[model samples]
Target: MDKLKGKGKEAVGKLTGDRRKESEGKADQAKATAKDKVDEVGDRAKGVTDSLRNDDK
Candidate 1:
């Protein structure tokens, strides 16, 4: 997602000669960061569930 946004921003900046690429890059990075956080949370939840199941033995 961040890469996509950066590419898009670069393309648009090239087309329009605007200096908004920095902001776009930041937005892309934010999206990537959020996605990583969500993935981490999911992994933690899965780990907890697996541990609980194992303890049921």
Candidate 2:
């Protein structure tokens, strides 16, 4: 969502040659991507935990 916006901004900045905005957008995109990856890992871990618990029962 926000990451997509950042990507769009980055692309626009690249097209316009605005160095500052481009850098900011890149940073935002990186942060968002990192957060998303973390969330995905957390979800996967929870799923595995749940499966193990169910198997034990």
Candidate 3:
């Protein structure tokens, strides 16, 4: 969602030649990427925990 919005903003910024908007859009994309990576790591950890618990049962 945010990544898509950021991309739109970036495209608009490029079209309008707005440097500030472009920078902001880039920042938003970076934030979204970091968040996605964190979520992926957390999901992997949860999967591992679930597998271990199931093994004990």
Candidate 4:
């Protein structure tokens, strides 16, 4: 969702030739990407825990 919003902002900035808005949009995208990576790592950790628990049972 945030990623989509950031892409929209980037598109608008390019259309309007606003350097500041473009920079802001890029920053937003980077933040969103970082959050996604964190979530992916957390999910992988949870999967490993679930697998270990099942093995013990």
List candidate 1 segments past 4 Å from native. 1-17
- lDDT for model 4, please: 0.91
Measured with C-alpha atoms, the lDDT of residue 38 in candidate 4 is 100
Q: What is the C-alpha RMSD, rounded to one decimal, of candidate 1?
A: 2.8
Q: How accurate is candidate 2 locally (lDDT)?
A: 0.92
Q: How high is the CA lDDT of each candidate model?
A: 0.81, 0.92, 0.92, 0.91
The reply for model 3, stretches above 4 Å from the true place, is: none
The C-alpha TM-scores of every prediction are 0.68, 0.82, 0.91, 0.89
lDDT, candidate 2, 31-53, per-residue tens = 99999999999999999999999
* 2 versus 4: better lDDT goes to: 2
For model 2 the local lDDT of residue 7 reads 91
User: How well does candidate 3 match the true structure in TM-score terms?
Assistant: 0.91
Rate residue 19 of model 3 by lDDT.
Answer: 82
**Best-to-worst ranking by TM-score:** 3, 4, 2, 1
TM-score between model 1 and native:
0.68
Off by over 4 Å in 2: none
